[model samples]
Target: MTVENTAEATEVGETTEVTDTTEVPAPVEDAQIERALEAILMVADEPMSVVTLATAVGAPVKRVRAALAAIVADFDGEGGGVRRGFELREVGGGWRIYVREEFDHVVADYVLQQNPTKLSQAALETLAVIAYKQPISRGAIASIRAVNVDSVVRTLLGRGLITELFTDSETGAINYGTTDLLLSQLGINSIDELPKISPLLADGADGFEGDVR
Candidate 1:
């Protein structure tokens, strides 16, 4: 009887242990979610919506949204891994990852730290014309400047300051325009923010007259 009672007690203890193990699993941690989110962001070329990312990761939208918020907060926190190193920004109505403004100098230094190449005065003048009259053709650019600008335009294209926006439908002439990177470098929000040229020219008439060829 003593041995039978001991066996029954052991069985009861085993049943209790099994019952405890059958309970629901723990919730996913924020750190785990952040790692997954970073992977998705790194692979995406454009800003990814929360719903889209949730579908890709097989996680619920609510959870993904919470995770994104937490990740942003984590990056924004003092002495955070991303603080002053990188930035998370929302552009074109979506989120994107980019290096912070403060670190741009460092990155530029590392990538393009070579001796600075100076643009000739003629090249500067050509660039100014193209930037002011974008969607303009090379012929138009040359016409306005009354000089050949093929080399200048090519240099701008090589520097990534300008890009071919489109070709004229009828003539197939390439139309050139300034890039977003150019705007960023110029510290202007848009081309419209460029200094008004007519007034500037008017203001500098005496100087222009002094240097007229």
Candidate 2:
């Protein structure tokens, strides 16, 4: 009786093992992987690395990289369809979708027609400060404006109105300056064309406050 009971217990264990194996998830299919990659790449604001993309899609890095290459080729008409207006490109050490160079003017015109670019009152004030005191740091701009300018700086950078000219060697702070786009918008030839701030100030202060220099 003891030997018969032991054999029955062993048989039960083997059955349980087979049931567990059947519960395991199957490997992701190539078509499903490509779809997942497309969904992610569509909404991503910046270039995504293969490792990052893999983690998001729960796929292997090698497979994610392969899918990205395939997607890029598909956008380029490698699959025999007409080429898309945008293309997936690897830039700045990662991959992102960008408008094709030939369609830049069309996209620009569409964007302009969709909505006229307008600056807020705060943005106008911050722009004025940068115009007069160019090559200035964000901290200095904040000090002059008495408010944080992080988002404002990003907005200006996005609008192509300001740029990071260089980093300060001593403080490691980025110095910003108005871009040529701003100059053109302002109908000025150079930064020198900006009007003197002292006369515009209600207090007529000739010098900047603090060590913001």
Candidate 3:
């Protein structure tokens, strides 16, 4: 009975003893961060900002920025070895992800799939007239072309080579103009870079009129 009493007392003391165990969260992996960044880039229509990406990944802005930089650098490097891919860039006061120039064809092929033929001479001429005389109406393009350009304009719009800029003040007819993509395709920074026609025409040669004829 004395031994039992002593054991009971020891058991009571042990039951009163408290032990603390705390669990620490697992650390986030860099590979996980990189994957999250890539997923954001893939789905984003435009470039994603560092702040937005950080919020998405539940990470700090500095960390996200560092991650983006590393990812971009890696993609750009030969080690990445991905064809036709690039990184984020700042434009219009925001970041956007874009592919490298070389990959445009491949990307277009995958997404668009349909082969829309290049602009026809009539479409190009009509486009040129509108571009040089923007805020001009469809009537003006028709007059310059001496032919109906409704179909041509529609084709250009469908191809994303041109867009409606505004409506004519007098007639309320839609005014058309070239898009930045068109300018890029033409390899010119701006419309003003277009070749001067007076010199080209004055050299005993008719302008695009010759091309048309």
Candidate 4:
């Protein structure tokens, strides 16, 4: 009977140990949460919703919101710190990090200093196609170039040289076109002023015979 009592006590102690281990969770650190938010916001192209950020960091929405407020305060020099050149802003029902409006020209000048030359070869070719046959689809440009133009198109769009004019009704393909920025760069008032393609492509390959205009 003493042996039986000892065995039961041991079992109860083991169960208690297991219960103690299972009841505790690893502590969530504030610095860890802040770092996670920084990493995610750095690469996010669009504004992130609080719920999305909470889901990403495995924290509750309220906690994530509080963290965001804390981060903004930290960046804004509210706690007797240096004011950051960038700021966290809430727009379109979401949150994103943006350069402060006062520093717009500073950033733009730095970017221009980094690349002060003409457009890249791929960008030039893509711009040429858009300048001539614009309101054209990516697939059409790819067919003409005999290579994929997705990245090139994106570059042109980013540079403000091209824009999405419209989407096809049946195929739903986005049609791209040259922007006024391109016209200004080309020193032409309108796309109609572009040089004739046939003369320029007299010695070109098989797929280069069409008039882009």
Top-TM-score candidate index: 2
lDDT of 1 by residue, 118-209 (tens): 76798788778778777788888888788898888867765657766765656646688887667887899999888756556756442222
Which digits, one per residue and each the tens of the lDDT, describe model 3 over residues 61-121?
A: 8887788776766777747566337666554334556666576555544533353566689
Supply the TM-score for candidate 1: 0.42
Clashing pairs in 2: none
Give, for candidate 4, the lowest lDDT window spanning 10 residues: 1-10
lDDT of 4 by residue, 35-150 (tens): 78878887775568898898888788898898898889988989799999999977555677877868755655565456567788978887777777777988988988888888
Residue 54 error, candidate 3, Å: 51
The local distance difference test score of each candidate is 0.67, 0.73, 0.65, 0.73
Could you estimate the TM-score for every candidate?
0.42, 0.55, 0.42, 0.50
Minimum summed lDDT over a 10-residue window in model 2 is located at 1-10
Q: How well is each residue in 1-213 modelled by candidate 2, as lDDT tens digits?
A: 121212223564563222212243454566789878888888775567788888777789999988988888889998677899999987545677777878755654564455466988888888877877787988999998899988888677657677667656566576888877677778999888776666665567634653222
Residue 100, candidate 3: alpha-carbon lDDT:
69
Query: Against the true structure, candidate 4 has what lDDT?
Result: 0.73
RMSD of each: 16.4, 8.4, 16.2, 9.0
Instruction: Please count the clashing residue pairs in each candidate, in the order shown.
Output: 0, 0, 3, 0
